[model samples]
Target: MTVQSIAGPRFSWRGPSNGWRQREGRGPTLALALFILVFSLIPVGRLIVAAFEGGFGAFWQVLDAPDVWRATRNTLVVAFGSGSLALLIGVVFALILSVTTLRARTALAFIMVMSLMIAPQISALAFKTLAGPASPLLKLVGLAPAPGTPNPMLGEFGIIVVMGLHHAPLVAITLASGLASIPRPLIEAARLDGASPWQVVNRIMLPLLRPFLLSAALLAFVAGTGNFGIPALLGLPVGYVTLPTLLFRKLASFGPATIGDAAAISVLIALIAGTGVIAASLLLARSASRLETDHRIEPFWELGRWRPAVEAGVWGVIALTVLLPLASLLATSLVPAYGVRLSPSSLTLAQYVEVLFRQDLTVRAFRNSMLLAGGAALSLAVITLVSAYVLDRAKPKVKAFAFALIELPYAVPGIVLAIACILLFIKPLPLIGVSIYATPWIILFAYHARFFAIALKPVMAAMATLDDAVQEAAVCDGARLGQRLRHIVLPLVFPAVFAGMLMVFLLAFNELTVSALLWSAGTETLGVALLSLEDSGLGAEAAAVAVTATLLVLVLMLAMQMLARRLPPNALPWQALAGPDRERRG
Candidate 1:
């Protein structure tokens, strides 16, 4: 009976009696361990070495600088302020969409997701153009200030606003996921007790959502602390510097000579991000009890007389957040030059044509970004599949550590990752006698390190759902590990594998912070090129490039939407919204 139970009718467990147990080796596990160490650990280790290269001397210098302290102050202020604003916005929207009978919920949710994708720099750039005296949108409405008025978007205030708006959707999505786990019976019971809707929400829902709100705030704070593009574009011109912008300016002005100081700054950023992650982890652990229920709460709030007003308000916010600014950006891009009024008489596709066709640098930047992002996506897909397989077979403790290693680099700011790559590869390799610094190779390495977790998520999700009985049956037939993987595991998880690849490609293609410090003359990326154009005062050209990049991302998102049906549940980040949509329609 024991033997029959151990080796079931269709499949047999790995045992001494089966040759399958003998066929397993440590080769795959060893290879995966080495891959994780090289990709995740070495770069971080090099960052630590670079931070202390001069043995506490760099630390002393960094500590003594007044500007460094000011930047630190600014970083903290921005993080907390933006985080608070995001939390408020996120909580309100999440509650409205998740619990109410509001119309067009899907449309509103889609707008919010798009808002999150409107890269930080582009958001800043769009708002800057929309507010300037020369702004076509403002001027057309006769709200333009005088020509000499200082741009309102050139300071810390603008940074805070853009950061808050950019991250509000992220917080909303996180909180909605938490809300989905609440049991409907709890809320229904509260309502049946004659409690008012507001009373039920205030007394029952808020306490349950406290943990998720804190998690959202911490994530927003971490995002603000590491944000480079927003501050670099909006804050740097007016001298309102954050740590990330300071690091970028240091690297740009001093080049390799300031490596030690830059490394120290990067270390400060890592410390800030690390603290936030740890705090979020602890808060999540404490609130782990709230997520124990499995049944999701259904949408129960009837808007009654207020439904129309609520729908209008939600659509209005979406238009303000995504449509208005993007349209202004497009209008600016169509003008002949910066500050030119956008009208039929002045409109020209000259800038777009130049960037897309005539400009060698822009063309090269596009090519480089595509190649690097594409290469990283493909490479990470293959690597993550193997790593996921090994992780599935590992002990719990080993699996946890391996998972942590994958997430560490992603949680670290992109600038910090770039600094780590510089530290690791700045010197000539001992055997190769060549340096990867100032080359596209360094950018590729940073992408690999920073996006490892992103590429692993869908694969892990797919692996969790896989049936092990088939693999065991194959093993019973004397199948080798490679044969089982090729014929069984890969086929089961290919959808998720491809989904992860596409996600990595989309993220890496528009990424700026990692490539900001790493790109050289011949290795410019789309993000670097866009920023460079704006910094050089070619605002129209920059806007044109920004518009093009935005369209590319939207196209990819549409492609993903079309493929959503074929992919695994929750494979795409936005697929979770489908459930809410169906509920609303029904």
Candidate 2:
């Protein structure tokens, strides 16, 4: 029988029967495979080739650099440190929200997740502003660190702390999904056996969630390793460079002259990230448990007397991690200049006016970011809808390989993908003979390759829910493949399609890593513009840019939050936010 789940029906993504493939013929399957290979596999493969263009000598040359090795060491240490921290924070929030009567839990969960959508650089900037000697927020409270005192957030430790805070929500989202899988019967049996709420969690839930914990840890670790903005802002100024920042410095300093060297470094990064993924996969496989059930986890303990204290504690954490930093960022944006104390008399809107209206570069960045992100989102929505159908009907082996290719671009460091795009498209196309290098097209191409999977996942999951019976009936009634897809499947799955589109746009809009290497001239994304303003010593202007971008992300997130209520369970990343509400409704 098909699995019944917490959200309702748990749709298996297992491909349809071989007969469906036969009727559709090889055209769609081949087309999808080609699309995936061209966009994903080809770029990565081309990057690998570029890394070895000078044989083993060039690759070894990159590895031999003292700075390269130092950056690698730093990357590993920071990734593990931040990842462990994220695990701790995530598990606490997940358990508390799942099992305890935490008041304002919905708002807490929403804020926690919304924190994640704040761009990494913006986060770093905010915290930096908050802790700096001239911190407007701190100065206004007469607690700014004294001038000539070194900023506390300008080194390795700060990178780990900021990144950990930035990524904890990702861990929470992952763990929340696992928490929902826990069968209610097991918890009920424990309760009947006189087990306390804590006992049920420690004795049963955590063990079952081991696989998901490992998965979350891996996600946090990989994200840490690939993260550019955090290291760029927090680590780079003090010469505490990670691999990503090292790459950025290399190319930014020497431009095209260092492309070969950057490719070699990118190869090293991909290997490190890939090794981590493989290890995590092995760990997860070992820890796997069959957790499927109709009953989802729900609150087991009512903290009546302690509720206020617990709510206060949770809100305090939120304030420190999210609200304070953003407040500092806003204060910085309003100040007439960086390091100026924020006051009613000192505040000005000049930075916002300059960035939003007067600066040609910033204005173009806004337009470019929207076009690139909106284009990628729209294109992937259409492509994923078709690809999901083809994949759903393809042979198991074909489907698995295609899935791997689709994920590879996104899973590996964005720097790797950016390097791959440069390698693949640096020269003129064979037929067109027009180079896309140093142009917006390069950035757009990287977005498509990197975010294709993001757009595909929700759509694929939605495809899994399609009823074979309904399709068969449609076919029996003389409906063609195209007709059935157009009339029946598309309408049923449009919510997921829209959700995926929103996800892609959200990620692509404020993204920096890919465009860091790809962007040129008038083609700057918002991320590029913000970094430029900061580097040019226009900190107030940079803060304005960050605030603008963060507001847009929050607005989109709220819209998606409203949209998620109508989607099938787990169709969006923030689906975890809906679980407790779903439980309440049930």
Highest-lDDT candidate: 2
Per-residue lDDT for 197 in model 2? 88
Q: Provide backbone clash counts, one per model.
A: 0, 0
Please provide, for model 1 over 394-448, each residue's C-alpha lDDT reduced to its tens digit, 9 standing for 90 to 100.
Answer: 6666787888888889899999998988888889988989998889999998998
Provide TM-scores for the models. Answer: 0.94, 0.94
lDDT of 2 by residue, 1-586 (tens): 2322232222222234554455566766776887788888899889888899999987898889999999999999999999999999989988888888776676788788878888899999998888978788899999997898888988988899999999998888878877887888888899999999888889899988988898889989999999999899888778898999999999889987888899999988998888777676555544544676688767877677888888789889999999999999999999999889888899899999999999998999999999999999999887898899988766767776788789889989998898888888888989989999999989988999889998898888888878766765565567776887789989989888898898899999999999998998889999999888888888899999999999999888888778776676766555575364544311
TM-score of predicted structure 1 = 0.94
Error of 2 at 134 (Å): 1.2
lDDT of 1 at 186: 91
> For candidate 2, what is the TM-score?
0.94
Best by TM-score: 1
Angstrom error of the Cα, residue 24, model 2: value is 2.1
Each prediction's RMSD to truth: 2.7, 4.0
